[model samples]
Target chain A: MNNVNLNEDQQDCLQEIINVAMGQASDQLARYLDTFVYLKVPSIEQVSAQHLSDTLKYEAQSVAVVSQGFFGYEGIRGEALLMYQPKDSDRLADLLGYEPDELSVEEQIIDLSSILTTTFLNVFASQIDNQMSYSAPRLLFSSNADNNTSSQSSISEHIQHNSFNWDTALKVKISYQVTDYSFNCDMILLIPESAIINITSVIDRILEEY
Target chain B: MSANPFCTTIAEQLNTGILILDLDYNIVEWNRFFAIHAHKDAKEVIGKNVFTAFPELPQKWFERKLSSVIQLNTQSFCSWEQRHHLFELSHTRPITTDSHFMAQNCTFLPIETDKVISHICILIEDVTDVCHYQTKLNKVLDELAKANRIDGLTQVFNRKHWEECLDKEFSRARRYDHGLALIMFDLDHFKLLNDTYGHQCGDTVLIETAQKISSLLRLCDQFGRYGGEEFAAILPETDLIGAVDVAERICKEIEKLVIKFQDKDIRISTSVGVATINPNDKRYEDLISNADLALYEAKATGRNKVCSAKEIEYILEE
Candidate 1:
């Protein structure tokens, strides 16, 4: 924990902010779906840029991923990924008012990802007291259990392409479950080394103000 | 050459199928590979809705993938393992296998305009050969496993497999408290026959004996070559009487075998021993040994006769 770029205090602070942001997002989602949203306690860990895949590893041929970029203050930006099982798409589509068929399921996934990313990033930005902007969410990369051959490379490439020269990453993982349908989704926030430094200082300022 | 390379060559000349769709899911571009494989002209597809152009495409899945790609502005992939084929293109590989449609690996990439994704491009790679080879590998592995369990000469369960079957049957009989019987038999004076004739004649006699024994066995009975000039049968749900009756029939049928070897009349007979499940028989091995002891008695009394473990028990008591 000490070796992590963010010390224990900063990591805890980040986790606290993420927990609050996740709660707000979950409540919003629960209201939108007219169903209960189960949220797992969020955890944040500092990982090397190259080791991001290990930190974000998902079961092969089992998950579909959607990611989008968010801009933070001072040249800091990171991507947020929402991953879920393909089989859950049917239930999700039904809940989101989309017909679960060959045509509209992927669109439903995007709609779900966008709503989640939007709600999470908004609360996170406001909690940290930083002005932020978000790009339209888009499908970054997807690989399933069957084609595991390229999944590792796909994740690595996505991280490498997005992470840039940032050496360390603070990976935040949160789980959301639709209680009625039993569908689960993992929301991963990859904050780069530069972004965490800025956020840590922001946490220090907030603590000092308190 | 046109100033715009994308318009001139890249999309049209790429080997893999390239399809561009606008935000409304209308087809904006169709490459040569897509046109040829799909057997449709680019002019017909360029401005039509993607779902309308390929009605057979999984519309919901395609729409979901496209929406995710467009919304996230990222690349997404679909391998043949999840869905065999995206397009309903007929298989065109030189060595076509069982698959009717072309196997594909599809990639959806967002095409951005002014920092906003205006269109999505789908890249399709024909992976029929990969799927075909994987299927063939599985089939070959299956056949190899079957070959390992079967005797090459007699086409019956090999010794190893027979032992496994006997152990399984023994446990089932004990668990269900049902009767189980074993029959152990050997050709009468097999070595003498082998010495008088050649190994070729001995092999023929062994194969014929196995055929006659197997043909008389019930479907539930398991028959296998135990070893050189020896054979065994496992009869589940059968008592000593039923086993003895089956053994007697096999002995009589084998006795009637008139195998012709180079125009010479070669007669053969088998001596059989029968044993049924009992409190004393703890394992399949114990049952087999009891049957073997009965077989030894049959050989001692005469060359061609049927002996039961109960008779051996009476003899031991005497």
Candidate 2:
């Protein structure tokens, strides 16, 4: 809509940083789950909070999502999101020896997204030369929640209601596929205008050094 | 960080553990909950590294966790379902819990100083009750799943579940070119027995006959109650001859069954049919139909006998 918020050089730098961070995180997850993790080349965008749901790769399907808020060395803060499509959960639960039920499957996804979020952000923080601290991962949306529980009905409505004070954010998106398994998920980091403005200053410094 | 004295002391006195760790893993502040569990005073361990205060604490894992919390400025979590315990603290309630040590779920809350994180307040809550109930619930689920696959009277696999098992075994046998045999048997005079002595007596005869035949078959055999008075067993890796031998043994076992019910001995006999994967067998249903045809032949020719599909076909050729 508006001209690309990031200059060509700035976008390139962010992409390269995301690539390295994602690679390490994928390796760590491969070891954690003992399954091959195939990562896509990550993309970054600037979008308003209103259009966030539309921009997401997944449609309004009832997806399982885990959200964690991270604070950096400065005033930099953002929420990390992991949205998983509901596929092969029963098979994965059988593989993990968990009860192949809705609750158990949701718990499995939450535990995994925790490892993946921290590992990726830790590397991304080091790349940007900033320390990151986090809020505990929270189950924001669950396909299981609708049938089992009465509340938290829809994901887009959940995101819209929790839209941060700033309307715009720097959204980083990456998807991962578990090789030999039908499980896959998308990881998103949403930094509001204020926090990401602080982040861009750090990005600028990295680019200047280069 | 300034706090409400009322809330601060309340947290200090609460049952759950409340401790604040600096970026270096040093304990900045703690409450009586930690003091009581670790058997240490706040004055002694508050300034020391948490791992140093308790040598048994998993330092490497905790250090990595604290690092992620510090660097990512994010909180992580663990559950008893995952790793069980992070701190080895004992609870006062021994009678309630089966475990000696307490099961704890921890929360690492970042204490921000003008938007920058300086300390992590770790809240430890005892989840022994939840964990125990969850474990109990899981056990019940396992039992329910087992019950769903079994016949209520006979305690053998139900027809639907047995069909599923047969389908899987069919694919497996086809893939590996392995032998598979099906046995279908029916009580010769089941309707007369049920009508003469009531359904209760008939149920007893079925249960006893199922158990007897189950004991005679190999462990790999998949036994199920196919119909009201009919039962089926799938013997993987068993050829036609092996299946016939098993059928004869089962027929003899059922013939000798004298089920005791209401101070009376009820005698019952069964006719068995055997079929193995032949060149003509295409699908699992084909094998089942062949076995059923052999069962019809066994009942028609002579009750309390074992019949094979190949031999019945030989008689047809004559």
Candidate 3:
């Protein structure tokens, strides 16, 4: 399991922030998709390399994942990942009125997924970061494939072994539900715990000034 | 003190529509110009979804403009010339104390206010007349482009156009690994025809000959007036044998035509040189030069005959 050392207050604050950010993200996505989107509070947990596959097994095997990097106060930097099951991907394609069968190339699929993920993440990051007067959120990277392969094995192994520094790890999870289309998936925003602490301190300082 | 009369006067005098929206996107103020052009009274539009007030706007366009303002906190503008909107408008957002937008030339600008951080302002301007005239100018330019490719006298492809055709055919031949043939022909003793029948009669014969040859050629084949008294044809996907046959046919047809000029019967003939392009050949100019050399050979051997580069090679060998 990835080590998480958050006190109750910090956990509550992080959960609230994630909730608001995800809500805003869902709203923006809904506007783009032209469909109602419902996102749920994700089940927060620490998982090891051995449990990674099991954790993903309950989710769809064929999934579209988007990842981007964020940086904030005091050297805070981490990656945000949005995952969608195959069914949700189909729904997304339908919402966009794109013929899935016609998009055969990997480059085309990645471009389409990245466009959506960038728009959503841009909104989510801006809303959360703005409260502390942070720098404008920049989208570092995005992909829509099960990219955790051999090269990422070391990082996965470290997480599974609980050997990574907890102070530098913070993970937030969000699940989506579009009941009208019967589609759902878990979205994960992973940050180093130390980065979260720094961000929280900034927010605390801003709140105190208010 | 009376509200600055300049604000009201300018707002009313503008020809394009202008509107000021609050943070909630409700109209805080509307101008007379918008009321006249949009066909809606300002009193009826205030406090309504700007989109609802302008239901004719495309949903995607409306959403994109609205989002740019709300999220980026910047003014957005759209031109009528970009597409035919109900009104040609420009939008701008104001930088003043109140969040307001002014539309000019179909653009919208929103001014931000402190209490609400009025995120957007828009401006609009109408440019329908300019767009219409621009379209007319573009059409004239297109016609001019067509005119540039045709010969003024014969209404056939000119020498300049022939070069373009040959270049295109050469590239196609190389790409498809197919044969392309160039045939160059000159009216036999054309200067004598001008001396005997007058230049006007000679010109008539040239035009008639061009018409007859063009009738025999396929749509994909290009025939052009190479210069005074000379013409060239680019036959794509045709080899030396096919080009030789076409040249002979054109020669026989021209010989049969008895042109009556100045009450005298004149018989005209042409000498043709054919060259088959090798797909491996890199330069089209070399191919044309080879065809011209063969044409010189045809004229030397006989005034009215068809000659191929291979035949010229054989004669030189002899």
Candidate 4:
């Protein structure tokens, strides 16, 4: 619908908020691992789910995937994704004293990936929502799966067929390393087009509020 | 479907305790699991106040939470991971035409079974095994951390622990703008003693030396073996004059110790160097370097003496 466009100042403000959110996420992951975790803001762009999958192709094959949906007041919707290498998952399991292969997909909530994802997303969502003075983000769903062979095709197809209602978009991709472990992950944050416009207006309102 | 008998049979066969409470917080049903775990039969528990049957559950809070099931028409769940009840349980409440509660790993879930709206169910699961393992894990970690910080031979803090303590003390001194002093000492001709006797006798001498120095220092002081035949002490809130006095006392004590090894009366001596910290000094290395220079000065002038960094610096200037 091309509902609204984010100007330069709004874009910078959004990036700054995302930076703070990712920093909190990194701290939470570090605590879960009982070791220091590093996160960096690599690039921020506006793209569709199909393009996101395409851009992350090199990492998609070898990565452990975690995704979650966020809903705010007035039907504000967005998603967050974290992609980590299998080696990273194994290291995480080792830190938690679990055998890597013993972790079951159905019982995902008890695993290190889910525990960390839940905590990270909780911190990220709170930081963003509080800054915007929006309603607290409600967690719609969460899933962590290995997208090696069987799931990749289904995910790609789902992305291709789905029609998003978002009008303005903002995307941020971060690369991070964990200390004392040979593991890394790509943290991706996606805001729907309408939400981005809402955020820009919200920021202007905040400037006036202050 | 008349599945009550089957459900009762299954509940009786299970290992964990199960209880069903109505919206009024009265015991509607009790299973063999409860009879075995709680040592109370179903007949004695049924139709009684749930808290009265246990006497351990919070009477007021339990009633209030149970009342919410029918009023809110929603399921309430509590996990044992948050805090354990009288009996650890994972509890769940299910909202349905008839409400039921399930406990998982030490929880209590009570359900409402009203005809119009049964929206709450509770479930509780025992988590004694997980709790036990967690306690054991914590104890083992505490022991491991202690072992890592202690010296194997002397039963005192080792060099690694000493360094960590020094780092903390240095930061504290700088933060509070207070004075700290370090005393470094080495046994005179310790290699010769090891050669003359044996390694075991040398260890005994080191232990004895540590004990002597520890007895002479104040309770606020910390002492640790820095390396082979070498030891270091940290005296918080002590000035240079106080540190030198303590160092001199330690040196005299060591010189007086007589060790009987293989029927030979062996007299041992130690050279000590004392240095007061400058709060502005950023690196711990500087403190150690100053102490080492003072120790060398003590050895050069004559052994069995205490030297301060200021004296060593004056000598260097001369």
Candidate lDDT scores, in order, read 0.77, 0.78, 0.64, 0.64
> B202 in model 2: Cα distance from truth in Å?
1.1
Q: For all the predictions, what are the DockQ values?
A: 0.07, 0.14, 0.02, 0.03
Best candidate, lDDT-wise? 2
- Which ten contiguous residues of candidate 4 chain A have the minimum total lDDT? A131-140
- Select the stronger candidate by DockQ from 2 and 3: 2
- Tens digits of per-residue lDDT for model 3, B139-174: 665566667788988888999988998998898888
**Tens-digit lDDT string for candidate 1 (A1-210):** 333376667667767887887788677667666788887998777777667655445443466677777886755578888888776775877676446553345556766776677667766777876645665465544543333333443444555356446677878888888868878898888877766666667877767776
Candidate 4 per-residue lDDT, tens place, A1-210, comes to 334556677667767766786787666656545678777665877776566546555455455555555555443456666666555554554654445454343222223333444445455556555311112122112224432222334444455355656433677677777767776766566777757766666667645655
TM-score of each: 0.58, 0.66, 0.52, 0.55
**Model 1 lDDT per residue over B86-136, tens place:** 889865684547788889877777776786889887888888988898667
State the displacement of the C-alpha of residue B44, model 1, in Å, after optimal TM-score superposition: 2.6
Q: How many times do residue backbones clash in model 3?
A: 66
Model 2 agreement with the true structure over A1-210: per-residue lDDT tens digits: 233267878788889988998887777666655678888888788878668856442443557788888887977788989987676354665433344552356666765677678778877888888777767677766765533232234334556466445668889988878766777778888887877667767778889998
Fnat measured on candidate 2:
0.18
Q: Residue B189 in model 4: shift from native, Å?
A: 1.1
Per-residue lDDT of B1-318 in model 2, one digit per residue for the tens? Answer: 256788877876799888898888888888788778877766678799888877777665566556555554556676665555677777767697797677878876667788798999888888877778877865665576678789999999999999999999988898899999999999998999989999998888889888888898888899999999999999999999999998988788777777899999888889888999877778999999999989999999988998999997898899
lDDT of each residue in B11-111, candidate 4, tens digit only: 77876666666656677766665555565666677788766777867554445435433432323333333334444222222242121222234323334
The reply for model 1, stretches above 4 Å from the true place, is A1-210, B1-14, B20-26, B55-84, B90-92, B95-101, B107-122, B175-179, B279-282
